[model samples]
Target: MTYKGNSIFKGKFFVWLALIILAVVPLFSGLYWQGILVLVCYYAYAAIAWNFICGYAGTMSLGHSVYMGIGGYISTIILETKGVSPWIGMIVGAAVAMCLGVIISYPTFRLKGPYFTLSSIAIVELLGTFISNTESLGPVPIKGGSGWSLSQTGNQAVMFEFSSKLSYFYIAFALMVIGLFVTYRMSESKLGYYLVAIRSDDDAAKSLGINVTKYKLIAMAISCFMISIAGTFYAQYFRYIGPDRIFSYDLSVQVALIALIGGQGTVMGPIIGAIILVPLSEMLSAKFAGQMSGLNLFLYGVVMMLVVYFMPHGFGEHVVSILQKAEEKIFGRIKRKAKD
Candidate 1:
């Protein structure tokens, strides 16, 4: 097969297979388990989205929850008052998030390393505080510090409201698949290479005449749009939105954690991280529901420290390396046996 054909067979087929399994497996899962699957997809999607800018472009945003909160508020407010379908709200929310991304990129993109990270955190705190203090934007009353909630839209698929968790599961799964596909495609494209070059050394990339700022902004825009979509989905699924919940520092940490723990900069890292961490977090939450609340956080710290100490490159990279070695060893044995 040609290189293109080989790539398609190797990458696209597995993505489809994974999506199919996600879709089918939930049908057999109990209610609680199905919820976990949906949560995994949600966090995984956000992590992948964040990784586009942080991992590939090396922007290292620590305040991505800004976009998530904006998307949620935009979609929920429109759905609640205007009675518009969330299908449309998703697009609008994403557009707004993209604009904020572009706006922030101008100033934040100029800073690098910890400076950039601090700027991002500042933006999130500023936005959160502003939203909480503002009571009204023109005629529409802002939810402000109280947060907002969405009323039932009669389980209409067009409205993005569903009576069944299965429907939400499918939507979340599809979003996850889409995030993976986009990440994979971008990773193989020229833009992806440019992002990598910039990340490795912006001075060298600029010396080569590459527009580093432009590509980083592009990455930021795409990442913002993607995570914003997830935010809209979260609002629609849970039927509520709170600045604290959506715009919290914890949310931003979770997004970063998912990608970092699994293997940042790789397509499968965030997915792997989400698959393991989300479920474990949930289980810990369940176990400590009425008792020890901080134990899970402590355990997560320990796990993260161990991964950093042992597998500094991230778990996804380590796993991939191991699999390749095992495959090579098995193939070598097969060839030797045939020769004998």
Candidate 2:
């Protein structure tokens, strides 16, 4: 048993080593690839946030993009129009997202399974529509619209604009590191055990003296706050924000898919998922965007289906299991030889 545990620890050490190497790739990669890596970091953060709720709390949400969209729009507006620092704007955005999460949690904590999922989707659509029609907030124009303008030139600290992608990459990488650290702590703490119990069976968990609602709400707040940080990152990096782009259903789906593919309920699942999927998705979109629209999305769908069918627990869990089995075999042989 000790040997098995040591082997598992060694495997995790190597995983962290690999992550550290990938985190520094931007220092040497070209501008274009650096931009992609920045995006990978952003998605990784978002996926980790989603995993907190869906993977750990077992409350799947299809409307998490609502929080992301709100965060992005609010932060961008404050930074661009009101001349606020993006760093401060991020706090405001995260607060708003947390409030929204609280508001939704009150009514939806009673729901489970498909109903909760449907309600989440409805909330996102509702927020999207509201943002689109309410133009009184200083013209939050959609991209490519008649009144849309992408022009921005102002104070460096307030606007969060930079001449180089490297800055954005580093900022995103830092956030990803923070996200992973938080997740690792959460997965090993008492809250994590409660979340697992809640996910396994809410009724059983409730009977065990766990305050299901309280824990769920806490998870929702943490998840939304984390996702909002990613939203701030997005606004700063892209220098743009709109309902369709920031709060799109596609973004929400991407978050969920990343967590699901990597290993739901595991600390490193979302990061693994983002690292594997984001680059692949980027490559496919770049190659097929103009020639075959929708092809890349179709491929994503197929890939998702394959992962669900073959590895429902996700790649991270699969890797962990394999390492455990190998360790067991090695240690078993050693024990037999010692006895002989």
Candidate 3:
């Protein structure tokens, strides 16, 4: 086979191997690690959703948590008030988020760079405040000091509540897999190229007849819908949601940070970021619980600084480069031996 064909085969092999390893993790690990892996999948899925717009389309939104909050609140409210299954609520929440995405894009897309980022921040605060103050929307105020909850109703899969961390892990893993597939598909599509072009130079892309506004909205809608689905899973997993908790600016920043650290614009970047950062954060938090109040967060900042300094393009890209070189060297040796 040609070198390119060989490289593709090697890549696929590794991909399948990694998936199988992840699939079997819960079989050997205890509850704590299972929970950690669930969190890793959740954050990774959110990060991948954020990457579609921020990484590929170059739209830096600092208010994505708004969609998450919306998803959580909508799904929870429907389950409580209408007696509908959360499975149906998940779809409704995503639809609502997609509509919000269009509305948000209209105003914010006109602004670029820091201005857009600032707009997103403002939106987050506005949505949080709105939810907190608006009690008419639901029996329980979504942003009220008390927040909302979902009872452990009958039927695990139907109610979307699970008694086992293993179940949560599998659900989260499935979502993460879906997110990864979508990211890979989008990155390899013509839309992906258009997004990159718009991101690289909007003026140039417009000159080439690209509809910047339409494409930006498309990316935004897809990103919002994906994250909203994650929000639904989060609510079911935790059995609780509050405006302050789900709609925090910090959550938005965390997703962005994950993508940046993992290698934005690449399919594996967010997943890599989550795999490394989530477990580390959990370990640090567990080890330092009550002993060092802010040490874990402090350490996270330090690690991010180091990553920014050393692997500016993202650790994921750097790792990929290393692996490709290693493979090339090994294959080169095999070809040489065959020739001899």
Candidate 4:
């Protein structure tokens, strides 16, 4: 993660390169392949958003699926009942999610390490149960355990529904881009500095007059707000969402796993992680799901375990090292040729 080089090349070139390649991918991708890439972008966006709190701020949350569920439910319900757009739900859900994030962080920020992670899982389960069991929350229909589906608006751009998978892929890809930009910005801000300090040692940061709770709350706010928007995107793309899936602990784990496996807290880590994991999982599912339902998950666990043992910093650290070496060699050769 610390492969220093030319400021501009290290800062921006690889990021834009990754993005540009992804942008061009769909032009040659088929419908089925496009769907797989869509999921990759979706998970990548989730991982990046999760990185804000758990990665940089060093507060582990294994329950971010709660935010995703809240977002999907809000947009789906509004679109179903009021005939409004998911776009509006994205905005409103973000506000609600931010408030909820603050509420959760205010009390639990005192807890650190595994304790905070456990509390978040508990909170997610509590909320997930309530939404799944209850038929209605005030006026909006929860529809109980059966969940709800997004109303079809007939390939409408304003409604966020499209006929082709290409649109969804682009939308998901754009969301990832936005998440990357925000993370990049946050990493350079004063708030980012404070979070880094707190992550290193909260007490030491407190001694330095940093408001530890305030900054953590701010990070959670941004994290929840951004992730909720992704929820809307998921709902629109999938056209169906339920407590069992949206609010599932498994979803949170997937997001966290991707972020961590990618080298959490780094700019391109989650993207790299998604590029590695998503397709592998899909292939596993397609090849093994019939003979052994849980085989893919078992293999996934094995991969994660291996990663923990070998690359504790995830793939990003090594990837950056190699990239820097390659950059040096390439530019070094150019300079030599120019001198010749």
Q: How many residue pairs clash in each candidate?
A: 0, 0, 0, 0
Model 2: residue 160 alpha-carbon error in angstroms: 2.3
Candidate 3 RMSD to the real structure: 3.2
| Residue-by-residue lDDT tens digits, candidate 3, 131-227 | 7777775455344656787787644778887778888898889998898888777776778888989988999999999999998899899999999
Better candidate by TM-score, 1 or 3: 3
True-structure lDDT of candidate 4: 0.85
lDDT of 4 by residue, 143-206 (tens): 9899887667578999998999998999999899999888877887798788888988999999
Q: RMSDs, each prediction?
A: 3.7, 4.2, 3.2, 2.0
Overlapping backbone residue pairs in candidate 4 total 0
Comparison by lDDT, 2 against 3, better one: 3
Using lDDT, give the best candidate's number: 4
Q: What value of lDDT does candidate 1 attain over all alpha carbons?
A: 0.84
Cα misplacement distance, residue 179 of candidate 1 (Å):
0.8
- Per-residue C-alpha lDDT of model 2 across residues 16-76, encoded as one tens digit per residue: 7767887778888898799789888899899989998888988889889998877777777
Q: How does model 2 score by TM-score?
A: 0.88
Q: What overall lDDT goes with each candidate model?
A: 0.84, 0.79, 0.83, 0.85
Residue pairs with clashing backbones, model 3: none
